[model samples]
Every structure is written in structure tokens, then in C-alpha cells.
Target: MPVTARHLIIQGRVQGVFYRNWAVALARDLSLSGWVRNRRDASVEMWVEGAAEAIEQFIAQAHEGPPAARVLRVIAQPVETEGFVGFEKRPTA
Candidate 1:
């Protein structure tokens, strides 16, 4: 499977909703490596690197978030993988 990287910005009802933690669990389940953090602008940002299919699946799950999240939009773009070691929740940026 070919590896791919993507930067995703999830908007709306994300912060304070355990969205980052949810992402960490999902990413780990998918065996993806990267990080997720809360943006100052009230969005959740993530950089995920993994098999293309897995990344796609991650994105799909991200849209629903932790049941408390009311995801408004998810913007994803291709990025260069930094060979991240594991999925993690990062401090807000």
C-alpha cells in the first residue's frame, strides 16, 4: 500500500469536545502516524500520514467526531509526510 500524507482542518464544535482524543484513538487504530491539535481559531487541525486507504477512512471518521462535535466542514489537502512516529494529541496552536 502506498503511503500518503494529508493536512486536515476541521471546523465547528471541535474544541473542548475531546475531538483530539477521539482522533488519536482512531489514528492509532488505523496505525497512522501524525498529530492532532486545536487551532486558536476554533478548529481542529491534523497532519496524518499512512496508507492512502487508511487516510481516507480516517477522514471519513473525523467528519463525525466524538459525538459531541458538530463538524461543519473538513478541509483536506495533500502534504509531505514527515515520517511521524505515532499518533498523538498536541497542544493547541
Candidate 2:
């Protein structure tokens, strides 16, 4: 079932890393649309909307981000698609 979801990834060593860039690449590859950004609480936040299988792949990749991030947990929730066109880094919001 094509769906939209928001994810909050608690990464132990994600800051100052290339996690965002890696995520952008991955999301683009998966053809998913939405945004990714760094949170003030030192976590990475993502919103994605696309095919179920692609979103699944995104979740799997997010767990092991950039080979430099120590992903501790990935908290996900449902969200509205909002018809995003592409993946990008959102200015901290």
C-alpha cells in the first residue's frame, strides 16, 4: 500500500557526518519524495512518501546511514503525503 511516513532516527554519532547527503542519495535512488533534516535534539528527521516497497528499503538503509552514523533507534509514524516532488534537506524545522 503506497504510503507516507515520518521517521526520527536517533543516531549516536550522526552529527558532523554525511548522513544527510547519504540519505538524499538513497531517497533519490528509491524515487521517494520528501525531506530530511537534523533536529535540535541531535537526531535526524525524515518525511517520505512513496511506494511501500521503496519506503521499506528506505527504512532499512536509514538504520545504517553513511557507514559513519551509529543509528540507535528509528521511530516512525504515519503522515500525509502532501505530494512532495523530490528529496532534499530541509532547513531545520
Candidate 2, after superposition: displacement of residue 6 in Å? 3.5
Q: Which candidate comes out best when scored by lDDT?
A: 1
Give the candidate number with the greatest TM-score. Answer: 1
lDDT of 2 by residue, 2-53 (tens): 5665655556677668888898899999999898988888888888888878
Candidate 1 at residue 81, lDDT?
86
Can you list the residue pairs that collide in candidate 2? Answer: none
List the candidates' TM-scores in order: 0.97, 0.89
